[model samples]
Target: MKRPHLIVDDEIAVQELVGHWAFRAHTTPIQIFNRATDPFLPGVKTHLFRSLEALDGRGFRNPVLVITRWKIEPSDVDRLEALTNLKLTILVTWSGIDDDRVEPVSSAIAVGSLEVLANSASRVKKILYWRPIISGLNDTNDHFASARRLSEFADATVFTGLFYREEIRAYFREAGVPDLYADVARRKILPRDAERRILSHFEGRPIFRKTSCGVAFAHGVPDFNGHFGIREICDICPEAQHEICGRKHHRPDMEVVRSLARVVSLADLDGIEISDRRIEVSGSSEAQRYFMQHALNFQVHDRAQPHRQHRHGRAEIGWE
Candidate 1:
């Protein structure tokens, strides 16, 4: 029932999409235009310009998250800075993986982008998105050192795992690339050992377990996802961010929760559960759940799929 309209054509279509979505009071373009190819700039891939051009001047203070490892010039930063209304955060993805087969784009490109965004673009926030740290590939001490050095360039850093799905495994097999993980996972595969190594390496840094944490930290705002409720997830958060989130954290009223549940048209309102950690609802689409979540600035979970304790958004592959 998730009818997401894909706007891939002209500017008019983009404008129409933005116009329709602009009315929402809290629209976090959280995960969008990950690797958009820039039509104007050759050898550059970024949906940043076209998408942001449409979003700019819309008078929306929505948080926009654009994750990319592509080319982003200083000129592009200027264009991004011009957009004064939107709270934009660019997460430059760099894992230091040198394997041409696994990652076609060099890590240097993303490193350069991070540095540029950090040195320039005063208003626009940046996060050193250190991710997809595969074992024996980019998980070396050198990699960590390089990423640690790069972390200083951004407002914050978030280390995450690889999306080693069945399809990805198949592709790797076809390409004669060795299996990245012992088995594929529903979530990104960040093993316990790898996580420990990362934590140890990134000790005493502005790091986060979640992307929203880094994004919110960069923008100096509370986590719209309301992750502070999950104590384990917030354990890695900086004291300043933790305080900021704590100040804004409040258990939402049941009436408001009921209102959100109704917006999703849940046939049984009795099934809705709202704890400090998250709002749990059954029989709702992803779009409906996310709508309520972004609107309430709280975590919303489907009762059918319960998240594990202390391992909020992580894959069970490593923990087990």
Candidate 2:
């Protein structure tokens, strides 16, 4: 059987990574379409386009378009509805408008909340969720709970994150709110909790499970401390999982570790590789010091093999 053709929205780095990994594992050609340039690329079966009209000119079949930034409006869905063989996959951070009419052509999944969608295990072909630790205000618990619920409903869960326990925790700490850990721990299993609520929202649904992490930089910039630089100062609490890190300072040469190996979008990978690592180093200077101190203490008792690492190999990085 031919490998499924994956179409990722404009996220050149993610697209590139997915392309490389897909080709290596499933012989799939991961295509990319920048929504900023062309919003209707999903309707085009062949040839890339810079405008939606140009894309509509081609009759595409079962084409999957991954959206990262551009919002899908009613008009956009109308154009997509015109395509008979197109399949739309929207990878968004939060649920905004509804596109129920375009249900067949488009399906929306949160980057951190795939588990919520996975409850419909039958309808979903594959699931991709990443980011184990969501470091935000207390409200983020809802997001995590939703994701976990979706995972419960998936046929097979493919959970992928940068690092399992340590890195996730570290990321939270660097974000200036380590309390999120305690929050997730407190409400992980509660039905009313965010994770459980997400599952409940789509229970008994037929959906495949696929999860991934380490794409925080694709959408935004990082701080000086290699943490999400964006500030969440609302009463709603922080959904740290969707926050971007390391935009303030662009570190052309830095190394990131990919603990798990999987095919990702090339655009996603490039975003990580090219993001301002220096910002992380700088923004979290104080946090890094504290982390190092804690790491020293943990090292005395922790014994896990270092799994993966990605290096940019440059110095003099800065943070925003």
Candidate 3:
């Protein structure tokens, strides 16, 4: 029985999207925001609540991995801490250093939320998410400045390449918002120079790279999710890496990976030590499918095994 991962997103849709990924990973996906559902995999129990208050009513017996955004207040941290059975992880997605650069990523809430969360005495882990590194737009030296300044506030910084999806572009078009995807004509890979530029911003701070932004600090299949477990590309944030990321039961499935590596096109495995069960896999949707498929196969064999897995060390992907 893997520890249940509690998904806490204000948007039920986002929770469901990521929750389904966790579900496919064989990790328990517990919803913190209540929403009506259609049907999920059989024998999988689905838990939903109208609010955190509703969840609180049902006391947690096992230690839970509580996942939420950094746009939260210290009081929210306090409330989470009160749930002694829960371990907290907050993912911060805003990279605007100051007010001038804040507009694009700003929610209805104000910027500088990370600072407030940092100053609190609570033990929640913070992850700086510099995702969607839009080329020529938000990808600049200012990115480094913002990351350097906020790096102290977070437990680790995870940077990901920007890829455009048709559904998202269609939504932006329908919503009348300028699509950033149009800037690059919907390129799939994050520009290598842009990735380096963002990595440069984390000088003296712990940093890790992944295929998708915001994948760190959450529970799922790392290889499939496009999170290769090595900080070799960027300097590791020492202080932040030490913070507990609440993933104790999840471990990588080396045998499955070795088998998959032989059959699949893992271009990034060069010079990597797979015998240790650690390899740098290129971030691709096909790889994720392989990982997810392995996990599904386990369910057929024995639901208890739950299939494949992957994780990190200090400079590693930063999973607990």
- Quote the positional error of residue 247 for candidate 3 in Å: 14
- Candidate numbers sorted by TM-score from highest down: 1, 3, 2
lDDT of 3 by residue, 65-139 (tens): 333232555555565555433233455665443333323335222235567667773555556665555555566
TM-score of each: 0.90, 0.29, 0.51
lDDT of 1 by residue, 8-79 (tens): 553675566656632373465544544343232343224446566666655767788877777788888888
Candidate 1 whole-model C-alpha lDDT, 0 to 1: 0.79
Query: What lDDT does candidate 2 reach at residue 33?
Result: 50
Residue runs of model 3 more than 4 Å from their true location after superposition: 1-71, 95-110, 171-188, 211-320
Q: Local distance difference test, per candidate?
A: 0.79, 0.29, 0.42
Q: Higher-lDDT candidate among 2 and 3?
A: 3
Clashing pairs in 1: 36-46, 37-45
lDDT of 2 by residue, 175-261 (tens): 553333332221111112333333344444322112211212111222112332112211111234323322232333323211110
Q: At residue 140, what lDDT does model 3 achieve?
A: 71
Q: Point out the higher-scoring one by TM-score: 2 or 3.
A: 3
Clashes of each: 2, 83, 6
Q: Pick the candidate with the highest TM-score.
A: 1
Off by over 4 Å in 2: 1-63, 83-86, 95-175, 179-201, 211-320
| lDDT-sorted candidate list, best first | 1, 3, 2
